[model samples]
Target chain A: MSRDALQESLSAVMDNEADELELRRVLNAFDDAETRDTWSRYQVARAVMHKDLLIPRLDIAAAVSAALADEAVPAKAARGPWRSLGRLAVAASVTVAVLAGVRLYNQDEIAGAELAQQTQQPVMAGPQVKGPAVLAGYKESADTTGPMANGVLQGQSGWQDQRLPGYLRQHAQESALKGTESALPYARAASLENR
Target chain B: MRAIPLLTLLLSGWFALPAHADEAQDWLTRLGRAEQQQSFQGTFVYERNGSFSTHDIWHRVQDGQVRERLLQLDGSAQEVVRLDGRTQCVSGTLVAGLGNSRDAPSRALDPQKLNQFYELAVIGKSRVAGRNAVIVSITPRDQYRYGFELHLDRETALPLKSLLLNDQGQLLERFQFTRLNTSVVPDDRELQPSNDCTPIAVANSKAPEVQSTETWHMEWLPPGFQLTNTSARKDTQTKATVDSLMYEDGLARFSVFLEPISDASVTETRTQLGPTVAVSRRLNTVDGEMMVTVVGEIPIGTAERIALSVRGEKKPAAQP
Candidate 1:
C-alpha cells in the first residue's frame, strides 16, 4: 500500500469508522516498524486533541507479544543445563505478566469499589431506620446476612429456580435415606418442600 | 488466716477447671449411651430463622433394643419410627425416596474423636424443660462445620436442648425439649406409627438394584468430611441418570448431585435455603455437559468450592 493511503486507513481504523477494506489494509501493514510508529504517533496526537491522560511509552500489545515470544523460544531449546535456565526465564516472564495483570486488576477494582460504595449506600441506610440498637447488636441486619437469607439467587427466573428445588429435595431426601441422624436430614428435606 | 484460705481457694480453682472439662466430656459419653439405656417421652421444639415446629418423641428401651418414634405436633403428621437406630417407617413427607440400604449404624459420640474437631467446655449450668441441665459447648476447631451448645439433663445425662451456632456465634437452629419424662417406659401402643406412616422397603443387602457407576469424584473436600453413600438412578422428570454422593463429617453433611445437562444452557448458580446452601456449576465432561450441584448444611463459600471441584472420569475416545 502507498504510504499516504496506509496513513489514511490507520486514521480511519483509530476512529473506529474504517470500512472493511481500510481495516484489512491497516491490519496487514501493522507489522511494519514504520507503520507501528506512525500508529503510535497518531494515537498520541488523538489523545492530546481529546485532552485525555495517556500512559507514555506503554504499548501493552507489544509487551504481551514480547513476553509470549520470549516464552516460546525456551520450549524449543535442546534439553541441557541451558534449557533449565531458559525455563527459568519463561517462569520469570510469566511472573511479571501475572504481576502486571494483578496490578491492573487492582486499579480496576479500586475504581469499582467507589461505585459499589454508592450502590451500598441505600442498604446501609435501611438498617438505620430500624433503630440504633439494631446497629449496636451483633445480629446482622435483614437482607444483609447470608446469600440464602437475602434470597440472592432465587428471584432469577430460569432453570436454576426450576431445577434447584428438585436438586435440593433430592439431596435432602437422599441424605436422610442413609444418614444416622434421621430427624435433622428429614427436617431439612421437609423444609425444602415447605417453600 | 486470710492468706491461707485464699491460697487454698486458688489451688482448688486451678484443679476444678480440668475436672469441669472432664465432666463435659463425660456428659457427651453418657449422651451416646443414654439412647440405648434410657426410656423417655418428650416434646421438643426445633426452630430456625424461618421455621418453627414442635415434635413429640417416644423412645423405649426394652430387651436391649431401642425403639423410638417421633411425631410432628402441628401441621403435617410427620412421624418416624426407628428400631435399633434403623428407620422402620416414616409418615407424611418422610416417605419420599427413602432407600432401605442399611447405612452403617450411627457412631456413638466419642469424646476423644469429637475433641479433635470441637473444643468441648462446660460453660455453666442452666434449667431446661424444668430439669437442671449442664451446658456443654462444642465449638468447632475449624470453620468447615458449625458449633453446638448442648444442654444435657444433669440427672439423666440426656440432651435436653441443643443449639447449632455458626462461626459468628449466631444461632442457626435450636432443638430444645419443652417437656421431658425419662421416668416411665413408653409401651408398644405409643411407639406404633400412625395410619399415615408408610413402611420403608428394606433393600436386599445382597444386591442393590441401582448401583452408581461412581464416574465422578471431588478433587477437594473440606477437612474431616467423608463420602458416606453413593447412588445412581434415572431422574423421574429429566429422564437423565443422576448420580449422587453424600458426605458427612459426623456433625455436618453435604450431598453432591451430578446430572447431565447437555441440551440445556443452564448457567452456574448458587442458592442458600435456610441453613442449607446449594451451589451449582456447569462442567463439561467427556460424555457431555453436566451440572454438578453441591447441597448441604455447610458454609456457602465451602459449598461453592465443593461445586467447582467435582471432576468427571476421563474416557479415551474409542474412534481414534
Candidate 2:
C-alpha cells in the first residue's frame, strides 16, 4: 500500500502537479530500485505518447550524481614572476589587437572616402572602370548574373532576368509618371533605359 | 574646475548648430517657391552605373502657369511636355492608364515634414552651370531611403545639381546641368510637343477604374510609409492576374507586385540597378504560391524586408 502511494506521488511529480509532500515522497523513493524502474517506464511511456524517440537506458540523474562525486576542486596557484610574465603577454596581445582593429577601421574609412570622391567626379567613367584597382580589372564576363552584392538587386539570371527588367521599367516609369518629384523619377526611369 | 568652461563651450556649440539647420530649412522653402517662379532652360547629364545620358529641360512660368518640356539630347529623342505638372504628350513609348486626369495633386515639399525623416543641412557652396549654388545635404534618418545632396541655385534656389547617395555616401546617380540659361523664358514653340508625340487619352482609360481592394496587405512597413495606390491588371506575357500596390514615404516610393505562379520552378531573386532595388520572394497563401516582387529606389535590405512583410488579407467568416 505504501509502494502504491509512492508510485502515485511519482506520477504527480512527473506531471509537475505535485504538492511539496508528494514531491518529497517521490524523491525519497527515487533510491529504491523498483521505484527507479517504475519512473523510467513512466518516462518511456510519456515519450511514446509525445512521439519522441525513447532511449532505453538514459539514467541522466545517476550519471550527474557520479560526475559530481568524481569532480575535484581546482588548486589555486601561487603568484610568481611567471604570473607577471603571463600578464605582460596578455597586455601585449591586447595592445596588438587594439592597434590592428584601429588600423582596419581606418583603412575601411579611407577606402570609403576614396570611393565617394571617385563617384563625385564629373567625368563619366565606364561602370567597370570604377571601384578599386582589382575590381576595375576584373571583367564581369561571367554568364551567370547572380544576385549583386553592391547594387539594387543581384541574383541568379533565370526567371528574374526575364521578368525583372520589365517590372523595374514599369515601376520606374509609373513612379516617374505618378509622383510629384517629376525630374527625379524621370531621371530614374531614363537611367533604367540606359541599362 | 576645467569641466565648467568645457561644458559651456559645448552647450554654445550645440545651440549654434540649430541656427544653421534653420538656414537649411529656409533654403528648402525657397526651393519650393523657386520651381513655381523661375524660368530656365538647361542641358543636364544624368549618370549612374552602366548608364549615362544628356537631357534638356525647358521650364517656363507665365501668368501663374507652369509649363515644362524635356527631351533627350543624345538618344532617340525621348520627349515629354507637361503643363502644370500634367503630362500633355509623351514620345517613344506610351504608358496606358496613366492619364492626366488620374494624377492626384502633387504634394508640396514641406521642410518641417521632411526634417522628421531627413537631417537637412547646408554643407557648403559650389558653382554649377556657371551659377553660384548652395549645397544642401538631405541625409536620411533611416536605412529605408537614400540621401540626396542638392546644389540649389544661390539666386533662385532652383536645383542646379542633385546627387543621390547610398548609406555609405557613395553616389548612386548624378543629375547636374552642364549649361543653364535663366535669362530668357522659353517661348510657346519650345514648350510645344512635336507632332510625333502621342497625346494620352484621359477620358476613356479603363485601367484606373478597376481597383484591387483587400486582396493583399503588408503585415509591416517601414515607419512613415502609406499606401498611395493599388491596381490589378492582367500580365501581358504570362496572362496571369497581377496585383500591384504602391507606397510612398513623402520622399521615397516603392511598388509591390504579386502574381500567381503557374510554374512552381521559379526561385526567389533580388536585383539592383543604380539606385533602384528589386527583391522577389515566393509567398504561400491559403490559395497557392504567389511570387511577390518589390521594386523601388530603396535599399536592398529594406526591399527584402518589405517583400517578406507582404501578406494576404484575411477573409471574414461567411454568414449562415
Candidate 3:
C-alpha cells in the first residue's frame, strides 16, 4: 500500500469511523515500523482531544497485543458439516478474551462486573439492606470478580449450584453476626430465606 | 440481527415516559421509611443459591420509638431483636463483624445521596405477597454501580420486595416479604435476639490505624468515590504491615490493601466464589516490592485499574 493510503487508513481508524476494509488495511501494515509510528502518533492526537493522559512512546498496544497473542489459537474455519467445531473454537477464544478483560473491567465496576459485554447479559442483585446502626459498608462492593463474570455458569453443574448458596449464606451470616449493622446483616441473612 | 429493531422500539417506548421516574423514586423513599414507622409483622422467607430460611418478624412503633424483632421459625431458633435500627440481642449462628451494642453509628438509607449514583424510575407495577404493588427501578448512572427494582406496598409505601439487577436485567438476588401486616404489633418477648445471640467484638479485631499520608496514595479513582478510612495493621505472626484504605461512593464501597511480599513467589491470583472479586497485582514502589490486592464486588477491569493506580505517596514516580 502507498504511504498516502496507509495514512488515510490511519486517520479513519483514529476517528473510529473506519470500515472493516480500512481496519484490515491498517492492521495488515502494522508490522512496518513507520506505519506503527504513524499509528501511535494518530492515537496520541486522538487521546489529546479526548483529554486522556497520553504517555509519549508508551507501548500499551504492545502490552495488549502480547496479552492477546499468548491466548490466541488457530481458529477453525467455518465450513459445512464441521461448523460445530468452528463454533467451539470461537467459544474457547471468547472465554480467553473475557477472562483477561474481566481483570481490567473490575476497577470501575465494584460488584457484579460483567465481562464479554458484547455477548453476555449483566447480572443483577436484590435490594441492599443496611445493618442496624453499627456502621454502614458497601458489602463486598469491590468483589465484582464473582462466578457470573467467569462465564462458567453457562455449564454450571449441580455441584456449583449447591456449594455457592452455602458459601453465600455462610458469608452473609458471618458478616451480619461479626460486623456492625445488626439489622441489615440480619436482614441480609434472613433475605436468603425469601423464596 | 432481526431483533435489533424490536429492541430499539421497546427501548424508545421505555424512555418515552419521563414523569414515571419521579413516581418511582417516591415509592423508593416510602419503602425506605416503611420498616421504621410502620408496625407490621409477618413471616418472610429468604432464598439465594444453596441457603434458604424462614423467619417471623414483629415490628412496633409507639411514641416515635420503633422496636423490632426477628425469629427463624424453622430449623434453628435464629433470632434477633432491635430498637430503631440497633441490634439489641441475637440467637443462632450470628456470624461476626457486627459492631458492639452501644458503639458504631448506624448509617441509614439516605435516598437523596443514593440518587447520585442511581437513576430512580417507576418502570411499572407488579404484585407481591398477595398485594398490589408499584415497581420502582433504580438504574445506575455509571458502570461502577448496579441497578435495583423495588416493589412497594401501595398503601403504606413500604417495600414488600426488592430486586437487584444488572444492565441486562439478569436477577442477581431478591428480597421480598412473603406475608406482611401493618396493623399487628408483637409483644415485648418477640423483640429479642436468641439465647446464643452474642454481641459482636469490634475492639478485638479493630482495624489498624493509618499513621500518615507519607506512605502511599491512589493515582486514580472513579469520580464521586472518596477515601473514608485508612489503616495499617501489623500481623502479629508475620510482622508484616498491611495497609488498607477504604473508599465509598455513598452507596458503593471498596477497599485497597497493600502489603510487602519479600522474596515470596506468589503468582497473580483471582477468585470469585459468589458476588466477591479478589485481585492481587505485584507492583514496585519506593518502599520496595509490594503486592496490591483489591477485594470487592466490582468488575475485574476496574479492579485492575485500581491495583495499578496504587502509588507510594512518598514517591509517585515509583510505578510498575
Candidate 4:
C-alpha cells in the first residue's frame, strides 16, 4: 500500500473508526520501520492535541516485535508414535486428576457434615428454638461441599458458622422487603430458606 | 495525508458513543416503568453456584397498584407476597426481630443514577422465554460492583432474563423466565398468598428509644454508594444490640451489620455464596470490641474493605 493510504488507515485505527479492511491494512504495514515511525509521530501529535500525558519514546509494539523475534521456537521434529504416547500420557494424567478431585470433594463433604454436626449439638440442645438460624447454617454446610466452591468459608467453624447464616438471611430478607425489583431479591431470600 | 478526514471521523466516533448510550438508557427507563404499567405472570428459575430453584410468579397491576406473589416449585415451599413494593407476607422461615424498623422509602430503578456507577449499553438482541428480547449490559465502572446482563422483553420491556457477572466475567447468579404471559393479567385468585405464607407484622407505632442513640459510621464507602437504610435491633438469641446499615449504588446493594462481641472467640472471616459475599472484621471501639460484618451482592474484596472501614461514632459528652 502507498505510505499516504497506510498513514490514513493508521489514523483511522488510532481513532477506533477503522473498518476491518483499514485495520488489516494498518496491521499489515505495521512491521515497516517507516510505518512505525509515522504511527508514533501521529500518536505524539494526537497526545499533544488531547493534552494526554504520554511517554513519547515508549513503543510497545516495537518492543513486542523484538521479543517475538527473540523467542526460541520449539523443535517440531518429533512425530507419529511419540506424539500418540504423549497424548496417552496426558489422557492418563487427566483421568488420575479427575479421580483425585472426586475423592477430595467427597472428603470435603464429609468434613463439612461433621463440622456442621458438631455445631448443631449445642443449638439442638438449647431451649431457644431458633429454627431458621440452625436450618440456615445446616443448609449452607450441606450446599457447599467444596471448601472453595461458591467461596464458602470452609474450616473456620467457630463464630462464622453460628452467626454468618443469620446475617446472610437477615440481609437477604431485608433487601427483599425493601427492594423495588421484588422478584430477584425475593428469589434470593427464598433460596436462603431452602433446605 | 488524510488528517482532516481522520479528525472528522474521530470526532464522529466520539459523538456516536453517547447516542448508543442514550438508546440503552431509554430501554432501561422502559424496564423501570414496565412492572408498574404492564401486568405479567411467569415462571422463572433462580440459579447460583450450588443452588437452583424454580419459582412461579403472579404479578398484577390494577388501579396503579402492583401485587406480586411468588412460590417455589421444588424443595421447601418458599412464598412471598408484595403489594405496591411493600412486602406483605413470607412463608417458611422468617428471621426473628426482622421488619420491625421502618426503612427509607424504596427507590425505583433510576437509570440516571445507575449511569453514574455503571456503563449502560445495548449489546445485542436475543430470544428469551420464547419472546424477542433486547440485551442491555450494565457494566460496573469500578471494581467495587458486579456487572449485570439484562435480557428485557422486546414487546413489554419486562426483564425476561438477568445474569450477574463478577469482574472475571464469571456467572455468579442467574434469573431467567422460562415462561412469561404478558397479555394475560393474573386474576385475584392467582395473586392470593397461600395459607402457609404468614403475613409480616406492620411496623410498631412506638419507635425503639435506642434507634436515636446508637450510631455507627463508615470511614470510606465505594463511590456512588449511598446509605439507603439504618436500623438497630436486639438479637433474640445473643441479646446483643445489632446496628445494621444498608447501602446501594442504584443497581447493586450491600448491608453492614455491627454487633458488640464481648467474646474473644470470633475471628475475622470472609465467604462468598454465589453473588453474595459476607466479610466479618473485628473492630475495636471505645465501648468494647464490635464485630462488623458486611453482607451483600458485592465483591469479596469490596466487602472486606467496607468491613474494615466500619467505625463506631464517638458519643458526645453529657450536656446536663
lDDT of 4 by residue, B1-35 (tens): 22244345335433545357888999999998988
Top candidate (lDDT): 4
TM-score of 1: 0.65
Give the lDDT of residue B319 in candidate 2: 35
Tell me the docking grade of candidate 2: incorrect
Q: List, residue by residue over B1-320, the lDDT tens digit for candidate 3.
A: 32244345335433644686667656666766776678888877553333346678788888898787778777666777666665666654432222322243445556777766776666567777888888776767676655666778889877677655545554444457889887767777666555576554433244343243237678888767776555565544445666666666654456676777775555565544223445668888767787777755455566678888988756344444
Ranking by DockQ: 4, 2, 1, 3
Off by over 4 Å in 2: A1-158, B1-18, B202-214, B314-320
Identify the CAPRI category of the predicted complex in candidate 1: incorrect
* Distance from true location, Cα of B101 in model 3, Å: 13
DockQ of candidate 1 compared with the true complex: 0.11
Query: What is the alpha-carbon interface RMSD for each candidate?
Result: 11.3, 8.1, 11.5, 11.3
| DockQ of each candidate, alpha-carbon based | 0.11, 0.11, 0.08, 0.18
Candidate 3 residue A12 C-alpha distance from true site, Å? 20
The estimated TM-scores of all candidates read 0.65, 0.67, 0.56, 0.69
Native-to-model Cα distance after best TM-score fit, residue A160 in candidate 2, in Å: 2.3
DockQ of 4: 0.18
Q: Model 1, residue B122: displacement in angstroms?
A: 1.5
Worst 10 residues of 3 chain B by lDDT: B95-104
After superposition, the stretches of candidate 3 with alpha carbons farther than 4 Å from their true spots are: A1-195, B1-17, B71-80, B89-104, B201-216, B228-245, B258-263, B283-291, B312-320
Candidate 1 overall lDDT versus native: 0.70
Residue A105 of model 1 has an lDDT of 44
